[model samples]
Target: MNKKQISILGCGWLGFPLAKHLISKGYKIKGSSTTVSKKLMLAEAGIQPYIFKLGEDNNQEIYDNFLSESEVIVINFPPRRIPDIINIYQEQIRSILPHIKNYQKVIFVSSTSVYQNTNDWVTETIDNKPEKDSGKAVLAVENLLKSHSKENLTVLRLAGLIGYDRVPGRFLANKKEVANGQAPINVIHQDDCIGLIDAILKHNSWGEIINGCADNHPLREEFYTLAAKKANLTPPEFKKSETIQFKKISNTKSKALLNYNYKYPDPLILVR
Candidate 1:
């Protein structure tokens, strides 16, 4: 049997580590980076490096070479924060649609931000009414991909990423009177992020939307404060607020379909 050939677009924080993990599992990796300097790093880590910036790199040949013969494509880049981002982000993904083979499967790295603050638990079936511009961009791209080729795509909506270098302790450390203290946080560790994706590939789970989040939702104040103290940083202070807005992301679909077991099932586990 032939080994799987996986192409990862935007091999920065999460994609870079994901490529390494997949390589260890005996998958051949073709990874992309906007920075030409990172070519050596990716190659050393066993990734076939392709250097090009989406939207700016108009060379179709580079994209073709990067995507050629790969069975799975992981679209892992986040939409840039800017005015008129909905159009811009949509265009970026749209540009690649023509290049993707009809048989190839895509795993789009979406975010929980696609769901608005309903102060209740949300699943894949909930209608997306995103609150922020970034969320709007991501949702637009999700729609674009689905409309383009719904059958070969799987959207993995992740919560706030924490683990390894992404220490929750540094976020709002020594901050005074931060807002949304009472709101419950939806977060997942980087390890679980990789694990969830692996499970999706292993099970050949496609043509679905899945949420990848920890099992437990911790109050923002509780998790961040404990995280800061664990790192020996000054804990942030949160103001008392009666108005709390939050959306607890549900991972039931992922668990049932992919048989995924979150390595860090609780946000507090990272701190404790």
Candidate 2:
């Protein structure tokens, strides 16, 4: 049996790590970066790096080649702050969809922000009423891929990603008066992010939306304070305020269906 070729769009941060892991697992990786400088790094990591700018000129041929050659495609691009980011994403999807016709699988990396802040528990069955601009745009792209793609599509709605050098303690190391200290914080480590994708691919799971978040939700103040203490910094203060509309995200579907276990189940465990 031949190894599968995987193409990762927007190979930065999470995408780059995913591509690297896939390569190490004996899959051929073709990754895209808008910046030309990143090509060298991708090449060094044994990835066939392609320079693909979403809105740039004369780049359709490159994207088409990538889409046609890869057996699986992962779209991990973030929306830019254009006046009509949703429309732009739609256009990009339309452009790429044609080339990915023969691909066996497609993974759309989406955000948990697609859920409206409702101060309740949210699951895959909940109607996605995105409250933020970026969330709305992500939801639009997800719908476009789900409705139009002929291939099996898997949508992974990830919580705030944290790993590598991007730990939360640095975010609040010296800050004071952080809002909503008592509000529960939801996050997933990058290792688990890649692990979830690995599980989905290994099982050939598709045509489903899975919430890719850790099982734990700690009060913001407690997590941040512990993070501060670990980093040898003073814990920031939190003032009690009116609760913003937010919900505890449910990962039951991901757990049941994929049989996936999160490596970092607790938010505070990462700091300790």
Candidate 3:
């Protein structure tokens, strides 16, 4: 069988590792970097690196080359948390939709933030009511991808990613008066993300919306405090209010459809 050719946009935190892993699995990986300097770095990792920034001049040809000769394309481009980008981030992502159909499959890397914090368990079928700007932008991208492809698209709404080099403990270390102490956290490990995507590709699963998250749901205060201590950092203090608000993201759809066994099921244990 011919090796699977995969083009990954935004070879940053998650895409970089996924590229390396795919290479090890005998897949030909094409990666995109916004900066020219990173091309050497991507090449060193055994990825075919291309430099292209969506919504920029001369990007059409660059995107054409990047999408060419690739059977699967993973649109992992994430907007940086800048106000301007987050505001029009959907348009930035939509700019590439015109060039995506050449590939046999597409993975639109999205975020679980698309689901409003209804303080209820989140599933793939839940009604999306994004409250934050980031969530709204992600939803718009998801809709754009869906509109473009009926049979070849897979929308992965990833939960807060936590893994190597990403010690979540420090996010609010020593912070005081944090609300939602009892709220549950919805996070997935980078390892699981890679594994789930790999499985989906292997199984040829498309036209699905999957929520990539861990199986366990730990309290915000408990998980963060434990994470902080594990990293030898100061624990954050949460407000001891009686009001409890939380949402536990469910991964039943992805697991059942793909038969994926999570490597880091319980984030509380994976903090180390």
Best by TM-score: 1
Candidate 1 vs 3: which has more TM-score: 1
What lDDT tens digits, residue by residue, belong to model 2 across residues 1-272? 66799999989999999998998889999999988989899999999989877755587798777776677899898788788877887787667776676445899998999998778788988899998788889999898887776358999999988888786877777776677776777788999889989988888888889998889889888888888888788778776675554578888988898898888899888777
lDDT at position 260, candidate 1: 80
Ranking by TM-score: 1, 3, 2
TM-score of each: 0.97, 0.93, 0.96
lDDT of 3 by residue, 4-112 (tens): 8999998999999999999999999999988989999999999999987788867888888899878999989876777865557877887787887744699988999
| Every candidate's lDDT | 0.91, 0.84, 0.87
Q: Which is superior by lDDT, 2 or 3?
A: 3
Question: How good is model 3 by TM-score?
Answer: 0.96
C-alpha positional error of residue 206 in candidate 3 after TM-score superposition, expressed in Å: 0.5
Q: Once model 2 is optimally superposed onto the true structure by TM-score, how far is the C-alpha of residue 109 displaced, in angstroms? A: 0.4
Q: Which residue pairs come into collision in candidate 2?
A: 117-245, 119-246
